[model samples]
Target: MALSVVDLYRDILPKTNCGDCGFPTCLAFAGMVVSEKHPIDGCPHLAPEVVERCNQELAEQYAAGKWTKRDLAEDALTWAKERSASMNLSDLPGRIGGELLDTDSGKALKLPYFGGHVIISEGDITRADDRELTRWEKVFIYNHLSQGGSRMPIGKWKGFEEFPNTVSKIKTMAGHVEAPLVDRFHGRLAELVDAAKRIGGMEMTGKAHSADAAFFFRPFLRVPVMLLFWDEDPADGFGATAKLLFDETVIEHLDIESIVFLSERLRQLLCDAADEAPQKGNT
Candidate 1:
């Protein structure tokens, strides 16, 4: 195998995204290297021996042919695909909540996605309707298959930031997901609720939670998320706040980065659905 960015991101580089590598994130740095934009040894965190190993691999790869920029794109997905390839296909359904289907080519796992379903077969993964998935959606799917999480949702929810190695992603979550949501639906929580339902979010009503609106979204079969939003109340000098929570078993289902990507997709879907829905004038 060539020394692809996937190898660097998942195996060689420190996943901390510590910024000591000149680029802001490890994925960025890996992409930079794959495009020959930077040296492989740019990351100071890597051991000299590790750097030497990567250099040897890259040298051999370069001798073979050029690596395309597109190849470097979506290192997470590449890593996930590589992981899925190494996994035992038969073991997937037992771990994740999916049905093993017999396709003419090979085995496929039919897993739930939001309310729809996706078929995961070697070299070919698509929605039940066969609609092409976005890059993020592909990452979300492959990450689920790669992890092969066996535990069901624990029925208890906690903030996404509580997960290990997620401290760096907290700001990302707040800025990209939370802030936009609060701005768009602050005093219009009713609209927010409608948007949630549009995206297959189940209203978790009669539940004891601090948020004014609560929804449970099973974005992936074994990976469910609780979206809690505190509507703005100007009378109390409070601003709208939002948080996406996960079951206690989330850490076992997907890595921290995938969890953040999943949330970003949720934000995009919710915002789009809200824009399309008919508005309610007032409560």
Candidate 2:
């Protein structure tokens, strides 16, 4: 197994939020070291020997493909929430293209999620209806805010394989993200399009396009995802495939793990919506 951020926090480096490593907290520093390949020796509290050992171990694991961007869960959420909370929520609306609303509790920003909205305050994020989000969902949103991305989408699209350092995640995106949708909507292209539109995908007319269907989505201000579906043709022996394309600018807004997580969640939402839409085959 790869060296995990949680393990490194628990084992090495004095657990002090000393900010000696140029991060706000030790957890933040550890996450940077493990995930972003920040030098492990940046923590001033670590002895030279300790840094040497960790550097050698991490170097080997990373070279062996054991190190990849982690989900940044649990304590990661803690650090992310703290980091986001320190920002001025009032300024987040312009920064993220979110709508600020005055609620009885205080103020919050309503950001688009799938086809719906999620309200994020300084303390926590909730669905538009005030329901709690899963830890991963919360963490994802917090990390987005922590990234502080503000670039506008350039409109060009690319596949997951186009990004740098995405080799470890290409299979994951295929198996978990694309394959599931392909399996679910194989013979149900009509249903798939309906679900996608219902969940904020704008149907795109295929003009001289080889793809059977295409749709576009702006899951975030800077992060736009395009879906290209090629329905199976039994006569041609072609299997149904769903390929998700991302804006070339997505890397600036989301890390690898978060982008994959976003896709998985989007697939779930699309599948759920398709189930609820009137199914032609159901009758």
- Which prediction has the highest lDDT against the true structure? 1
Candidate 2 local lDDT, 213-244, one digit each (tens): 88888777768888888989899999988988
> How many clashes in each structure?
0, 0
- Assess the local accuracy of residue 226 in candidate 1 as a C-alpha lDDT between 0 and 100: 86
What lDDT score belongs to each candidate, Candidate 1 first? 0.83, 0.82
In order of appearance, the predictions have TM-scores of: 0.73, 0.69
- Highest TM-score: give the candidate number: 1
What lDDT does candidate 2 reach at residue 125?
Answer: 86
Q: Measured by TM-score, how close is model 1 to the native structure?
A: 0.73
